[model samples]
Target: MIDSHAHIYLEHFEEDVEEVVERAIANGVEKILLPNIDSTSIEQMLRLEEQYPDVCYPMMGLHPCSVKEDFEKELQIVEDWFNKRSFLAVGEMGTDLYWDKTFWEQQKEAFHFQCELALKHDLPIVIHCRETIDETILLVEQYEGKGLKGVFHCFTGTVDQARQITNLGFFLGLGGVSTFKNGGMDKVIPHLERSKIMLETDSPYLTPAPHRGKRNEPSYISLVADKVAEFLNLSRKELDDLTTANTNKLFFPSK
Candidate 1:
């Protein structure tokens, strides 16, 4: 199975990062994608990728919430990295209005700049939309016909919104939030075609039901697959096959 989105670079796993990754592999997770938060996290994420080259693939981008007054400088650093190395994608980038709106303009600028990078590099992206679905959709539409593609990670939108995103050739990334009793993803997941979906853990956050409120890790991605299987009325193996195939198409395009 593939964890299409995760933050194993965070300090939460600094003490047992190796064990955490081992647990994920033991749990059946094959590949894990690490999306960068900002320039600050680049080295740590790159180190994790190097340490576990087979399992951890690094993505470069400035997270919406991380956009600040120095966002331009941060983006310059990201651009420089992209020029020097090949990354999985330009991602974990989008608009986040859930937090302070002070940096809304900066977020938009950063997102557009990253989108341009994706176009130039001919790579996909991992969008991080939070309470700004409308704005994000608008930006995505602007990239239409420019070969822009990627997943909307931690998706929490209406069926109509999901359709809109998929229509634009993007995938919906489902994680542990779907397992929440009150998450409402139960309703949303059923409406989405399995082909347009990809599984993710977003760890160190959104841990599944039995482990909710605790620190999330890639090992719990199975819980998400199980929930998705139940939601779609399919077997676990079926869900895994379908989502894994979709993930491979999006993240490992060459393969």
Candidate 2:
């Protein structure tokens, strides 16, 4: 299976990222896509990619939470990287109003900027919409026919919102949240379009049930897959095949 979204490059795993990758591979997670937060993360993210070129795919973007005063400079750095190298996608960028709304306007600006970057680079986007899925959807709708595609990473929206996103030709990335007893995804997942869904772990965060309070890792994606399989009423293998194909089609189309 492919862990379509993860941040194993973060310091949480610095002591044993190698072992984390091993555990993920052993647990059948073949690929772990890493999304950049800002300029500060580029080096460690790329280093992980270089060390595990085949397994750790990196993406470029300035996260919404990082959309502070110097956002333009951060975006310029991200753009320069795109000009310098290849990335699987342009994201984990989107509106996140969970913590504070002081940078809401800046976050919107950055989100649209990166959405254009996705289309400009002909790449899928990985979104992180926290407490603002609808607003994010409205922003994304403007690019519906411009060949902009992506996944709503760590999706926890309602069924109606899921319909809105998938109808816009985007995919919903499910992770540890689905395994949460209070996550409320069980009602939403069953109603989602099968092909418009994919699996992710968002590692080092959103750790799943049976390990909710602990740090998440790519290896735990199988548990995510298992719970999601239950949600969609498919066997583990079926969910694996479906999500793997979906993830490849989106981020690794050449494969």
Candidate 3:
């Protein structure tokens, strides 16, 4: 299985980072993609990738919430980082009105800029949409045929939304939220064709049931897979195979 998105480089795993990764591997997680938050996190994320070259792949971009008055400078730094090395994608970028709408216009500008970067580099993206799906979809539609490939990380949208996104050639990223008892994802999952879905943990954040409220780790990705399996009425192995295939197609297409 692949944890299509996570932030294991965050300080939350400072003490047990290795163990957390080992536990994930032991539980069948084969790869993890770490999306960058901003200029501040680039070093930590790159260091993690260096330490676990095969297991951790890094993405470059300024996160929605991180957009501020100096967002252009931050984006320049991100672009510099990309020019210095190869990155799997140009994201963890999108619109987020949930926290502070004061920077909505700036966030939109930043998201579009990063989307352009993805097109220029010909890499897939890892979008972070929070309470801005309508605008997110609108911006995504603008890039339609530019080879704008990506996954809507931590997807919590409706069935119609899911269909619209998939129709645009993007995949839905299912994470720990899917395991929440009352999460609307259960209904949303059935509406999606498994081929259009990918598994993720968004770790050190959305920990699954029986472990909610605790610091999430990649190891808990198994719990997510189990829930998806139950929802799809398939065995865990079957679900893993399908989702893993979807992830590989998106991130490691040649494989």
- Give each model a TM-score: 0.99, 0.99, 0.98
In candidate 3, how many Å is residue 57 off?
A: 0.6
The residue pairs found clashing in candidate 1 are none
Ranked by lDDT, the better of candidates 1 and 3 is 1
- Best-to-worst lDDT order: 1, 2, 3
TM-score of predicted structure 3: 0.98
Q: How close is candidate 2 to the true structure, as a TM-score?
A: 0.99
What does each candidate score in C-alpha RMSD?
0.7, 0.7, 0.8
lDDT of each residue in 61-174, candidate 2, tens digit only: 999999999999999998998999889999879988889899999998998899888888999999999999989999989887889999999989999999999999999999
Q: Clashes per prediction?
A: 0, 0, 0
* Global local distance difference test of model 1: 0.93
- Model 1: per-residue Cα lDDT over 179-221, one tens digit each: 9999999998998967899999999998999999999999999
lDDT at position 219, candidate 2: 95
lDDT of 3 by residue, 168-215 (tens): 999999999899999978887877878989898898899999899999
Off by over 4 Å in 3: none
In terms of lDDT, the poorest run of 10 residues in model 2 is 91-100
Better of 1 and 2 by lDDT: 1
